[model samples]
Target: MRELVFALDYDPGWNTLADTLADFPDARVRSLSLHATADSLWRVDHATGSPDALSAIEDAFLTADYYADCLATEPCGADSETEVLDETDDTLVLYTYWQRTPVCTSIPHLALEHLGDGLLFETQHEQRRHTWRIIHPEDADIHGFFDALHAELSADVNVEIIRLTGLSATNTATFSAEEGTLTREQREALTAAVHHGFYNTPREIDLGELAEELGLPRSTLTYRVRRAEAEIIKQYMNHDPVSPSDPTS
Candidate 1:
């Protein structure tokens, strides 16, 4: 399999959803699941933010203009609809079903047309940027798909290719600290770092601040985090699946 990572930046006036996201910079949206066929598409999206932001996003989802702007296609037909599957003060889950696939120019449609089936997609939306990660068969026509994507996008949408890499079947292995893949201290440090937004863009907290919060020396915290990260990456690269228990037992 091969993986492709890319991002799309939408100009403020060109996309209602993007503009709304830009208005609430702290809000984020992620695709929880997606299923698309030649004639239809359905997806579940999760959004997290302040209540006001969530409200605004929900409003956008209810509007036909948002779908039109998002898919870069004509307005949704009568058969299309969106439902709020769940909602809370700071989070919203939406399920959308679209039946007008023939007029849609969404990424999924384009991918299905050019890349064939069995492609896995992960997406994240923040501010005006939408990022996509696609894992597809090794024999897929990646360049052709890229060209089709560019051709389908509007002039106001800017696209960037972040990565294109081959993946071994085992490279999909994941790490679980609870399975003894990481030492206790390392897990704690890593958890603290993430909880404090150390990995966020423009980081919400610095290493020194994180160390102070954890009551640890800066170097100690740094070392633990680094070691934890190294272990996770090693597991991913080495395809060493962390089993919950000894299979031989």
Candidate 2:
């Protein structure tokens, strides 16, 4: 379950963003979430990195300063002008602005150093500003995207953000079908068909609905299911038949 993240500057813009990942054929970025603050020009509220999501940037806490502070308090959410607050440190982090809250500085259940690692990657002489970023799973086919982003911003920014709040550190895919029962595609299609309520009693599901759920055109699904049905019927009749499309006839 590898993932990609992009935490670019607010003004760098999406053309620059697209230019950065232009080579990746499978890149699936669909939207961007914009967050506006009083002082800074703008920040990447969030970005798309999933098949199920378009784009959404909400309140994310990197330190204790924002831990207890209410996010989404404004109508426009974390992007609102009225939600601005004081920056007490050279830069604002959790305890630096929120006082001695244990959540930021000292939580026995977790090591604060782990959080700090992602916040700022440092060398003796260099650091980069970081922010929340996301990459679509479809974007993984574009291996160059991440490398290009790192190269493009390495000279100017101290840090960049990638979203993991919804991603699994590891994914376990379990298929219920036996090896002879179905092909991987059928197993996947069946699971997706279940998403359409195809197995439900009323037969209320539309073929288009099942196709959409399975991420295929209804015509393709119809062809596959018909072929499969023909096979099932032949097997039930204790006879074998060449596939309709097979040319060995």
Q: Pick the candidate with the highest TM-score.
A: 1
- Candidate 1, residues 1-249, lDDT tens digits: the string is 667777777766767777789999999999999887777778899999999999998987887553632365445443667999999999999999877534456788778877789989898889878889988765666656766776777644655555555565445433343378888899888778779876655446766678899899877876676566545534443443334483521
* TM-score of every model versus the real structure: 0.66, 0.23
**Candidate 2 deviant stretches above 4 angstroms:** 1-181, 239-249
Worst 10 residues of 1 by lDDT: 233-242
Residue-wise lDDT of candidate 2 within 138-220, one digit each (tens)?
21322233333333332222222222222333322221212465555665665565566654432335456677766888767
Q: Candidate 2 — what's its lDDT?
A: 0.30
lDDT of 1 at 154: 65
Candidate 1 lands at a TM-score of 0.66
